[model samples]
Target chain A: MIELTVNGATHRVDVDPATPLLYVLRNELALNGAKFGCGMGQCGACTVLVDDRPVFSCLYPVSSTAGRRVRTVEGFGTPEKPGPLQQAFIDRQAVQCGYCIAGMIVRAQALLERVAHPTEQQIREHMNPNLCRCGTHMRILDAIRAVAATGELHRAGEKGPAS
Target chain B: MRWRRTGYVAGAVLLAGVIVFAAIAWQPAIPPVKSPDIAITPELVSKGRTVVALGDCAVCHSPEGHPAFSGGLGLRTPFGVIYTTNITPDVETGIGAWSLDAFMRAMRHGVSRDGHLLYPAFPYIHYTKVTDDDLRAAYAYLMTQPAVHAPAPRNDLPLPLRFRPALAVWNLLYLRPGAAPALDASPRERGRYLVEGLGHCSSCHTALGIIGGESGRYLGGGDVDGWHAPALDVLAHAPRPWTVEQLSAYLTTGLASEHGASAGPMRPVTDNLGDVPPEDVHAIATYLMTIQTSQPPTAPKAGAVADASQLARGHALFDGVCATCHGDGGPMETQLGRPPLAASSALQGPTPRNAIMMVLQGIPWPSHPKPTAYMPAFADNLTDDQIADLVVYLRSTTSQPPWPDVRDEVRRARKDLSHD
Candidate 1:
């Protein structure tokens, strides 16, 4: 059994140590926000935050996440009360297929947390790792830009139930 | 009274020594010549191009984003940094004023047209063996190039080494001027001339002494820019012994299906070799094969079992980090035909330096030509402990014993990274 703290809640799970974190998040913990795209690290569909740093959960072993805080898209907010970044996405309609949005949001959250008001160039460069095949990049950028403009990222989760 | 006489004797001896040294070291400047109006034949220029390619002049003299041969690349040495000189024929800053005789003397004697002793970092010791005809050909090719007026940077050496005349003593110790001994007309002989004279393979592949001369181990392996240049004479001892055909392929394309891709300092070398004629590469390979020292392949030893927790950590790290490309049935192996990690020379080598370097500074994607395999650098992404774990896990898969000094190697590689 290995201890994993996801979204501020701790859980003990029994799984192969080498199994990717994405598998545990989706299967055992039932946090299905992080999806599987390419099993390789190429695609960002399985991105999640390990101690506030975005990593490809599909390629990240669950063993390595022990004692470290892991945050999935579910940690942002519920559908009833979306986080500020999430609401920005909805406001901008930044989804075509929605497969890559969770990763895009998580990656952008990392950038915003590090830089409260990132410039256009900073946002583009920081978000470069996460790919949006649906060509929803412009809308995603607008959504992230909207969140950055308001400086309300800290209030993103205040209304939602704490994990 | 006796001590004062002794001091005077010592002073006189020192003064006499300085005078004698100056007499031996001072080289008279060759009178400057007008840029010659001799019409260079296209055929001669083409032949000169081949000669220049074999010599790998651009690899040193052409800093990236600079015009070809208009040099400003700083070569790091144990003594200090020596910057490459502009070889372009610009009359003001480059070698435009140098006559053919001046050029030949620089090649043969490691002296500049301005009567200063040239640093051995220019590799004139090996160049001294180049035939006069080939040197003339190289000059023809260089003189015809579009001249850029980039002046050479001053070397950052210790105060004593700043005296250019000190190199005259160094030359006396190491320089051997004259053409390479003529040989029967064979591909191997042609390969020898190129390798010894122009290619100067031994300059890197051979170990160096404390004073920076060849240690006489002669292709017994050496380090350059922190990466080990593996011994060429022991190619037979490689995990999969290198054949002439495979070596030729590797020399031309920078990849061998049986061995592995070139990385580190060898990458640019193989890239340059790729542009040369295939026959030249084949001849080089042929010559290299003839020099291989025969040694019986050792039987694989049983490795000591690693600590269970460390093994788990290492395995997990590999699955997460390396498995995307290097795992069994990975995309690189299945689709792209990259060799298994078992076949990698770095993993199978006695030391873990190369493996650590490869992980920290992954094979960068080449800009020109068709792209080959590319691995992203993990220097910032992975910690020193994490890299050591990965290296240990990879070593466990092979028949070789675990590198006991993996942590040290990782730290060394990190230091090398910062130095770069």
Candidate 2:
């Protein structure tokens, strides 16, 4: 049994420790926000935060995160009370088909946590791993900027319900 | 005995050395790509941009966030979903390292730089018709794009379809010979090349009938990813059949009079083809109008009639199995606003393979705002010969001009349908 805290909920999952965090989150924990695009660490659809650093969950083993805090798209907030990033996504219409939005948002969330005011180039470089098919990058960048303007990034250190 | 053993050891060593040497020599070299000697002028760039717009290479080949032409798009087909490969000039991942001749072979012949036959799913059959000049320009434009190093996922075709060698036979039968067959013969011919070659009309328009060669006719519909190829027939009775002007309008805007908006597979085609030069689009319309409507070129003349006894047997089988939808008023035209046999382009279109395929594999109900016709697959109920005769009977009665000897072709289509 491996005990891990995802989105604020502590859970025990029975699986091989060597299994990538993505499979454990998806198959055992029933969290599908982390997608399995290219299992070989090419596409970054399976991005998540481990102790506030972006990691490709598809390549990150569960054992490596034994005590590390894992945050996912679900960790953000519910639809009724979405996080600033989620609201920014909505305002900017950054979610076309919603397949890649979770990963993109997660990456952005991690970036904002590190750098409060990121330039467009920094955002592009940092968010390179999270791929979107519907040409939503410009809108996504706009959404990120909009969230930054709201001063959410500066106060990212404030804990919100352990998520 | 000791001498013999020594000889054997020496022989083994020699064999290993030869094998290693051969592998070193045969390391499938990627020939260097040479840009045309002509200077890159504003006019050249503008022309290349137009081609890019028409080709829409950026749409499928380049994912939204990826560098332009750094491909990773997932294209779903019936056989298996294939990912688009990177077209960038990256030496490690993209075609940046490909020779001009290699690129030409890949585009015109579907052979890759590694000397492997690419799957027809790549639509090289249509790209094969691209002129040397246009291909060079397109290559030049791609070369100028950013070099992105990202290898795409390989296609996962199921079972025998994965067998690459068999494609050679399929190519021999279906693929037209030679590159962009001299369009100088006529203006209409040039238009046909542009549409059929660059436009890739056959990829969607040609119905892959239950049989082989029997299904090569252009713009004869087939189901791909649940999207039916709407007949582009010029006949007055075709479903929302458009005049040349109307066709151009629809191709440009993805909408037309009486017809609903183009959706599904057609969306991409129109999205790309709409950007083509107005004159080119008009030329396509001209060529499309000239599609042989009376009959296919290979159809047998009336003089070589089928045996009367055989035809009689075919008639009886048709009545027993096919009379329900296709009988009495002789296959209702305008079934659910879709034209029936009386007004069908099928009667006037080339080849009976599509009709035969429909009978064997019954079309999936067309998806529209309003539900259209549904036909059930009949493989379980009918034999190959029975289906063939039924097809012949339909053509003899409804379609003008006799059909070609399609028995073997139908047999092949049936085999493929069975596996599919």
Candidate 3:
């Protein structure tokens, strides 16, 4: 048994200690937004936030996340009312097949959280760790850039006062 | 005449009461309709022509050697044969007399001017995602095509299936509510409109459900026209993940580094997509590469070198037989610019079929702009076992694992090999 906090919700789950966090999130918790791709951590499809930093869930053991806070794409917002970042994605149509988006979004979310105004090069460098086969990297770049230039700053400004 | 209207309704009621199964109409969540602003200028026609090409309408609508868009192509499906309708300006047989309103309705609602429910094979489900301006332009362009007097052949359907009303029921059961695409207005958005709307990329790339609607992760791939339409999503299963540059290059030119080349139905698609603006193709790629899925990795490959004995056999064969064109600075590399074996996309994908297909049926004549460096078929020249060993040798040298059934793949490719 392990304790896991995901998207602000906590649950206790029983599984093998070595079971991948992605498997638990999907199979046990039914949090399916994070997808499975290359299980070797070569593809970022199973990306989620561990303590607000993006990590490939497939290679990350569930045991390692016992005391950490994890966030999945579902934590972002509902489809009807997506987060600013997700809305930016949909508005830019930055998704296809949308299997990688949860990771893409979470990874980008981490980047934005760290660097509120990343340059295009910074954006590319940050996103290179993830692989998208559909060739939508440019749109993904734009969606992130758009969010950085506009909404990211506003949210960052709001957070600076408290943090 | 007075009783005809009442008779139709009463007969429908009686039919419903008797069968209780087949007579119900399907109700789809239809998007709110928008009246298109009409224009028939030459520029609009030119734009509309691009839209038509974007849709690849001619390929399916007109069979080979037939007048373009004449609409006699038979699309075989589980249900039955559904023939494409003529869109040329013929009053009796084609849509010549359809007003802009009628055309808009057809594009948006999948209904004919006479109110016949169209079979989904027409891909109106995707077309409805199109914007009114583009729809108008496509309509204007279609109207300009030379009128074809050809009437579509009668659909060979059975008694209950012959009635178009069943489509209403199917729509009710399967069709999700349609909503106007919320527009944010970016080039990527434009790409989305073309891809999701007119290009209908998902139609072929997305796997189909039991009832024929899109299933699984959209663009996760399925069979289309007898060829495996590889998934466009992140579970792409390409031996090497497609880089955006490689993807754009392939989508625009039909060949990408490492993945080799597009063949089968993809050839024509590349031809049509190539004709679109380069930026538009990039936009489509931009949209494609972002879709993600995850799966557990395949077991780590045993080793770079396979069984030492088989490796030696494959090496000897390659040196003796394949050495002429495939050796370092060999004819294929120097003259044809074919990548070295280590870099071949065929070797990189999850399966060996593409590589075997290449060996058995060398790239015939590449489309123009792509240099034509042809290779002859090796099926007649080499034994299946030898060919399989050669591929295994190539695989052993690369970081990629040897495909599971090399001999079986070679046999299959040889059986289907043709000069075309």
TM-score of each: 0.75, 0.48, 0.56
Best by TM-score: 1
> What is the alpha-carbon lDDT for the whole of candidate 2?
0.66
Instruction: Give the alpha-carbon lDDT of every model.
Output: 0.82, 0.66, 0.71
lDDT of 3 at B150: 88
Segments of candidate 1 deviating more than 4 angstroms: A1-163, B1-16, B36-38, B296-305, B335-337
Q: Which prediction has more favorable lDDT, 2 or 3?
A: 3
DockQ of each: 0.25, 0.01, 0.01
Best by lDDT: 1
As a TM-score, model 3 comes out at: 0.56
Q: Which scores better on lDDT, 1 or 3?
A: 1
Fraction of native Cα-Cα interface contacts (under 8 Å, chains A and B) also present in model 3? 0.00
| B100-203: candidate 2 lDDT, tens digit per residue | 67777788877778866677767777787788777777776776677888998877768887766566666776677456654476758867877677777767
Q: What is the Cα-based lDDT of residue B56 in candidate 3? A: 83
lDDT of 1 by residue, B85-140 (tens): 89999999999999988898999888899999998988899998898778888988
Clashes of 1: 0
Residue B298's lDDT within candidate 3 is 55
Ranking by DockQ: 1, 2, 3
**Residue lDDT tens for model 3, B1-420:** 879999999999998765754334432323322322355789999999888888888767766545778898877665667788888877778887777767776776677867677887888778877777777888888888888998998876667877777677666654543424527666667667677888888888888888677775677666554345767775344556777678888877776755656665676677677788888888778777666456633543343345787777667766644565678876656643345667776666556666666665455444344543344444433457767777888877667766787788677665544212
Rank candidates by TM-score, best first.
1, 3, 2
